[model samples]
Target: MNLSANNLCLSVDGVDHLENVTATFQPGRLHTVIGRTMAGKTTLLRVLAGLEKADSGSLTREGTDFLNIPVWRRNTAMVYQQFINYPHLNVFHNVAFPLKRAGLPRQEIQRRVRRSLASVGLADFEKRKPSQLSGGQQQRVAIARALARGTGILLLDEPLANLDYKLREQLRDEFKTLFSDQGDTIVIYTTTEPAEAMMLGDVVLVMHEGRILQTGTPQEVYERPATITVASIINDPPMNIFAGRIVGGQVTVAGFQATHVSAHLSDLPDGAYQFGLRATDVSLASTGVEGEVTFVEISGSETFVHVAVGESPFVVQVEGIHDVALGDLVKLRLRPDRLFAFDEKGTLMQTPSYGLASVEGR
Candidate 1:
């Protein structure tokens, strides 16, 4: 089933919790809704599932007006953060409950139940009660239940949030493969984690303050963020931002350009502009300007170091936890090509960035 929203909005107590939101989810692909807390992620999911009515907007599924459809007849199922199961019911009964509600025949329900359990690797635990299973297993049962009910659209609101990191990662891959194999069954999942969004989503949507900021493939969103917020959300350490200006043919970054963009240098008239540089774009060199190290965090794979360079503090990811300590003076320099310039309003500036060759031997 294909689902689309137009001018969708949901307000509560005079506040627009979800406003003017619109997007389309094609069948057989996973779409991720990402936003920070209070951004109306869950509210939007409820509206799509027909659990909550939008204040103003239209929803269509397969060319039919979905808002006109009742929740029971929508063929949409919601899996919540909490696995809601009848405590006394066994795994088989819990999964079979939705089929019974749909009035499916006993034989069909039994077949669907068994198949669903096998899909989530829970076939052997059909007779076990909910309390006897772990949290991960309980969530798998929840997913199996949705599948058994013949749900056309699956709405997951942070389904794996409460699981351990290892299990969460494992389930993420499993869920992606499951939906990939489903072939035309729509799955709308929401999460605030950037890594999860990048991993599972065929289309990633960045939302904030009740609106969709940007939607594109993971690489599209990361390589070319539509807004400053989108860039900030996609990167783990986030893009570094500093205030500077273009004055007298020089792009001053914290009062020092060292590197200049002369081709379209006159584009931005002398004024304050925010300089955005990712940690990967900046590096430490032997003969660069000396900056004091503020902090260092080693995470097995790489070492993240914060250094103060003039008025701007930059983060650099070194190979490993070296012998560097806080307050140590280190020579630091930005990789010219990786630097991104933004205007005062957080919009990216239109200009060619300097390349690594421009800074390496300069």
Candidate 2:
């Protein structure tokens, strides 16, 4: 099933929820939509699932118009952020509900239900009611129900948001493995967390303000963000951005200078720009600007040090534990290959030869 959304536009009460959004969802691959709350992630999903009508746009499956078909008639299944299950039914019956509605034989229904349940790690909980299972287990039951529907398209809206931290992590791995082998199923997942999108999406679509900001594989988007907004949203601890200027063929931010000038900036008149670097790319140096440590966060395997260089503050991620303390002065250096330059309008200035290597080279 190839799903395509062409110039999709939706509005309510004079407010636009989706603005000319367009994308293609290829069969057998997981596509993830990532954005902040109210960024139109849910609205886009609802529109695709035929739960909401678009004011203007075209939706098609295999070149056939899909809007003429009713939501119930479409071969699509949805799992929401909330775990929805029939409290009165046991896990087996809950998963079997969709199969029964399709008029499958008793044996076929039992077989499909068992397979779906086992896929979600809920086979042993078939006899348990929703009230008797943990939140994660109940959510798995809902997933099993969707799987039992045997739909070609699966729409998941932050399905793990309701689970606890540990459970979410565990279920992420389980869901990844479960859906990896579904070559005929087209899965669309939406999430606010960048980490979740990177982990689950074979292709990721970044959205903001009802617009499709960027689309690519997770690695492509992460390594080469198209804009400053993308750089800020796609990172875990967030990229450190500083006010900068191009001076005499060199980019200068705070007290740090670029070791080499990028050809992309050769034509631009010297002016203000934004310099960005990931925390992991900033290394402690023996000879560099002195920064006062403002905060120190030590996890078991890594340490996050927040330091203030002059008036600008930046976060540094280091491996394992470090003896750095608050108020301690440390020297920091930026890896030129890992630095990003954005214009005043937040557009990324591409320098293929300046980074570690161009995308093609890698």
Candidate 3:
């Protein structure tokens, strides 16, 4: 069954939680909603699950009204950030709880429980309680329980958020295989991490301030962000944006002008524009745009230096650690082919050409 939401709006205590949101989900696909905190990801999911009613909207499942359905009868399952499993029940019984409540035959429940446990790599731990398993193992039990019932729609809200670094990585890899080949199931996952969204989602939805900003495939969204907000949200450490203008085939910022025109952007009409560049695409050079180093971050084998050039801020990512200190003057060299041009209103205009032909933004 396909699910669709249209013009959903919700507000509580004079604050808007959701605003004019519309999207359609098809079966056999995983959709990952990416946004920062309070972007209404949870609110939208609850509305779809019949947990929260939208103030003004229409929800339909294959053209039938979905809001009238009770939450328990919606045939949906949700996994929270916390590993939710019955503390007193063993792994086997915990996964069998929903099937038992639904009045499935004893033999059928056993068959499904075993299959689900094995799918999540928790078959050996069915005899253990939640407390006996480690954090990642416990989450595996929760995931198994959610999938065991054969629900039509599955919602996972950052299921690995509480796990350690190594555990998160391990589960992320596991999730890639677990969620694949979920026949006729529409899976929706919400997360704050861009990497998580891009890695797992068949289609990516970027949200902000209770609104859906952009929706596309992972490659489309990453390569062609609709707005400056999306470009920032889709990249780690966010994309660096600054005010500048292209005049007579020359690109100049408001202050500390140094870079030349981008080869792909030089043909565009002269006007004030915003440029978005990834941290990795920029570097420190002696004969380029100058700025004052405001912050330095040493992350593993890479160093990220934050610099303030005129009124624009930029983060330059370089290999290995560098001894960059605060208040240090530095020169930044930006790749001409890696810049994303935007209009004054922050809408994307033209994308850089790495290999694909640069196209005009919508």
lDDT of each: 0.82, 0.86, 0.88
A best-first ranking of the candidates according to their TM-score comes to 3, 2, 1
Best by TM-score: 3
Model 1 Cα displacement at 280 (Å)? 2.6
In angstroms, what RMSD does candidate 1 have relative to the true structure? 2.9
- Candidate 3's C-alpha runs over 4 A off are 254-260, 356-362
Which pairs clash inside model 3? none
Provide the clashing-pair count of each candidate structure.
1, 0, 0
Task: Give candidate 1 regions above 4 Å deviation.
Answer: 246-250, 262-272, 287-294, 323-329, 350-362
Q: Which tens-of-lDDT digit does each residue in 230-272 have in candidate 3?
A: 9999899999998878777677763534345667787789988
How high is each candidate's TM-score?
Answer: 0.89, 0.90, 0.95
All candidates in order of lDDT, best leading? 3, 2, 1
Better of 2 and 3 by TM-score: 3
For TM-score, candidate 1 versus 3, the one ahead is 3
Model 2 over residues 54-157: C-alpha lDDT tens digits? 99989999878887789988889999999899999999999999888889999999999999988988778889989999999988898899988889889999
Backbone clashes (count) for model 2: 0
Which 10 successive residues of model 3 have the least lDDT summed?
353-362
Clashes of 3: 0
